[model samples]
Target: MGVKAWLSKPLAAYVHKKHQSWIQNPVEAQQSVFESIIKTAQHTAFGRDHHFSEIKTHADFVEAVPVRDYEGLVAYFNRVKEGEQNILWPGKPLYLAKTSGTTSGTKYIPITKDSIPNHINGAKDALLSYIHETGNSSFLDGKMIFLSGSPVLEQVGGIHTGRLSGIANHHVPGYLRTNQLPSYETNCIEDWETKLDQIIEETIDENMTLISGIPPWVQMYFDKLMQQTGKQIKDIFPNFSLFVYGGVNFEPYRKKLFESIGREVDSVETFPASEGFFAYQNEQHDRGLLLLLNSGIFFEFIPTDEYFNEKPTRLTIGEVEVGVNYALVVSSNAGLWGYSIGDTVKFTSVKPYKLIVSGRIKHYISAFGEHVIGEEVEKAMQRTMQKYPMVELVEFTVAPYVSQDKGQSFHEWLVEFSIAPANEEAFAKELNAQLQKLNTYYDDLITGRILADLKIRALPQGTFRHYMKSQGKLGGQNKVPRLSNDRKLAEGLIESADALNTNKN
Candidate 1:
């Protein structure tokens, strides 16, 4: 190890020792964070309107604030966007994280000075945790790259605003700044393809060690590099050791990513969003990401089955149980209260509050009441991949095929394959069998013949990327929905893939 890597081991040990204080006493840490944020925001407009002063316990806070998604709280966010101070949190926000929205067009989530550290430190400690465990921090001496959004911020109502990743770029520690790659000018290129080309040009010859990004984009980077240089990633960057990823599950992309790299590299998964930095993989195991209890965000969970009820039972860390899917809710210093971040998680370990993201509340295939979720499909796919070792997938999505005629309905899977399985029909059957094993409701439908066995439609290569580019969301945290109830996205994928194939021909 280099001097820097050698020194990081001691620092990593110190950080891990400090983190144990909360990891051991999670409930107390959560309670402290709850009191701190509530007390701080009590004077703000939302707090006063919700009777924050009268609140003393979790029940009191729950009664004072009703759980709401972005649509329900847009009024307060609108006021803030129009230059209102203390509308949600004290004074003005430090920055607004701009994100694409389906109905709202664009959302501006507040990131206060106090809350930003949680975002920065959660990522930092993940790396430190890895170093503390493996004592391998030599990667620190080599170049690192975080494929991210443009760092250019646009002023919104007198506040600096940009994508969450872009906002995070400005806060990278000075120590790591020298090791980071893809020049500022290159990152600012709004288009993903251009930015990626520039990235390859800049980092191809560097001793790259760590690469961080959402899996799809990183896959694209690898694909481009291999195409350009005719060499696997390991050959190009022999020192590369760590891969940091978030936004989506990694299992689906694991095979292809490893095949591209030509070897297995240690990786850390993080659970972050515009709302807050929630969790990170503290250990190099499948134990699940460790939830942040001492961060500036207080968490709440509603059982997924009860999320749509008139008033769902909100469970605090003390009440949450392992193996139950819960809709994640939060009250954060960033001025979001009883906010549903649209994510569903299941605690894998209640002691340390380690959880795996299950799926999104709005993104599922329940058209026939089977309620197939992202986690189920991902697990099913992982099983199928294990069964068919030769198969390699680029991307896939599922949607219900509701029949208007007298024909039986079924689920449709659109998949893009880099290495197609030997027998497509057999591959589809294995996938369907795996899905039935994971979801009993789906199994019942299949057995009863209420729904036909799921159908697989092989999509042309580059179809998903082409579709994303056509929609103006080619990179920087944009992800294809894993499952949808309706056929809107399914139909679009078919059309886009057909068009792409035609144009190529």
Candidate 2:
């Protein structure tokens, strides 16, 4: 057996045992996780303050530790930051996963010695499970490249701080480290342009077989590789067989990635966050991730429809129904207590427990009471793309333009297209119609004359890339906001496009 594959046997065994525990009875598995964490952390301040010692059941646990967003946990985290042990988790964390959310700005998420194993071993099992099912372990023999953030982490208080990918990379097994690409020095380059160049130069001639990154940055690398080598990805590395991705909806970029690679390859989708690694696509035919019930992260769901009410129902694994949108609440060994991660999801299956990410709870555009969401917008774009053969989407964001001068308001879409539609007017009309059909409030606003027809501004090619680069968020994991409550992002994108055109002129 290949050395990497040989090293994966133990992980495969772990996944086998864990997957059985999950699917046999998901509710029971999640209960086991909850009890374990509560028992371990009962001595901590958060546990004692919330009376976790007296909590004997899931319902009691929920009542003890109220569901909280990052803001609610900040006070407890501050104590941990000040070199306090057993404040949130069992001990002080060794590293912090620094996250600058699109709206929430910078947040330093904790990563503890107890919690780090969940991230590492679970990640290892995800790959091993994919291999066990696909029987495509030969790819492990060739170079595997993960396009990640800078490995050079900054010290925050007493802990090392960096992006989650960089923190995870630090714990990469010594065996797999040999097959990994891009020297540590290359990965530490702060400037994405410099790092991309160095990675391309270093791995251009390697016998690469596996690739992993978010879709957008991977697309960027593919574009550059094709441009420099004058060859498709398949031609460059005939053995290139796997592409693993996460952190954004992959459907929009699927066609582009296929075009770049020039052939179909096996792919695995994972749901990972600074909080914890939650789920992954366990079956090839089943795209919905098998929820990691046995993982160290305990899961709860508050139906989004009822979330804003005064004390909405929090459903355990036993209560969740397929097809309902729920705001995911998590309590992980990583020291978070009943934390709302802000992302929303819909369960696709309830028996074995699987789900697809719906959208972020805070990322919808409800200007003028239309209440449009990211999923609706994405579906609209997908529907339009089906009708227009000449059009390809790069990235898009929508914002309301309220002009006091005219006393009217409309959504202004800043969209960068790879191939311009043959008829922009018709394209916009159909897209608007599709969205109208999806959300009744949006249609009512248009019909009631409360909002004008959507305005589309076709951005120049590379506008989104340029905008992202300008913000120093050119890497994967950081996505351009799809829908904004305000015009800040829309105006910034428009300004960036204008600058690009001005330079060209």
Candidate 3:
């Protein structure tokens, strides 16, 4: 191992120890950490630019830098197109990670050579921590399969940015790179169908010891494998030891995967974005998701309720408390200072800084004045599933829409199932009832009968794949959107839901 790798273990140890202490004494620890980050941000590439140069201290950093949405990013990209070197940060970045922006279209997030180490190191710590937590070091010995996005990079007016999976593939050591299932260089540019076919062919005979990627793609791969072999996943990859996933919640699909595979697999959650890898599942899985506090990034949190309120307050890692939802913000070496990624997280425990993702700040349904968040939907679904234990939900999504004649808004549920209840209508009613009970706002809407619709569309086995295929977004970094709040996107999703219902009948 190189010097950095050699030093990483000790660094990881130190960070873990310090984080434990910080969690214990949150206020003081938070101040110290925030001050250090502010200092770092002011001196690094992020600080030297015109946009960030004006800020000098932690308070100034928070106040001067306005909270930005996708539109702000689009404006930055316009500068990038104009050959402006530093819109968000100083320095000519090495590459850009292309991601589908929620609203303002596609985004090309700048990634510098200095920033890549943060991602690699954070991922390394995540894997090491998982090993320590589960006491399952055997996973490291096996061939790990990562279902990533296309590796192809497109040069837009001489600026390079490709899908995140492709970038990760290209950055891996050459020796380990050969072990990867689909060659990133070839697969990144290949059509989705061709790529899926290649993935199926590669994994058919290989001993895939560990599988990692977005949940939806993993599901699709497993489904395809089962169809091809007529054998359960357990029969095919008996040695499969781990399932590492991120990008979306895995709870809904967890039971179904276990049922199909016939065994429990060790699972780890990763929080990575185009900007950088932020957090990972730590040694104490119960403590919550571990933030990569030492990843050359300054972290901040805005209380969930304060996000929409004017002049929202920011909290440092040390100041965050358990059960409080906060919008995650980061100032990274890659030049994004005080950037909010739109993810909302709740600290499960304060002592260890363990957190669970609550939901995306933008991804919620409030059509009928009932503000339903991702967590609310997840809890409702979990309760419904508990009530009806026999049926397995393969995939599900929730959207808010209004009935034209009724002039009242309600939630519509679309569920894809492998095994549905004997009485579908009764199942739907029970699910709706569970949801109403869990969320009072939903209950009020239902009681008033203002909630005009509660629809469940059971999809065929491969229905979800159609959306992934149509978008040309599968594997690796791309994830199936769970909760869509945007009206236009919801409409497109409804079309797919309708198609699935049509196919079933």
Cα displacement (angstroms), candidate 2, residue 130, comes to: 1.1
TM-score of each: 0.75, 0.74, 0.67
lDDT of each: 0.87, 0.82, 0.67
lDDT of 3 at 481: 60
Of the pair 2 and 3, which is ahead by TM-score? Answer: 2
User: lDDT (0-100) at residue 167 of candidate 1?
Assistant: 91
Backbone-clash count (model 3): 4
Q: Which digits, one per residue and each the tens of the lDDT, describe model 1 over residues 363-411?
A: 7775554657787788889999999998999999999886544456689
Best by lDDT: 1
lDDT tens string, model 3, 133-227? 45465544446788776667778646677777677777765544545665554466445556677888877898777888766457667777988
Best by TM-score: 1
lDDT value for model 3:
0.67
Better of 1 and 2 by TM-score: 1
Instruction: Please give the RMSD of candidate 2 to the true structure.
Output: 14.2
Q: Please give the TM-score that candidate 1 achieves against the real structure.
A: 0.75
The segments of candidate 1 whose C-alpha lies over 4 angstroms from its true place after superposition are 364-505
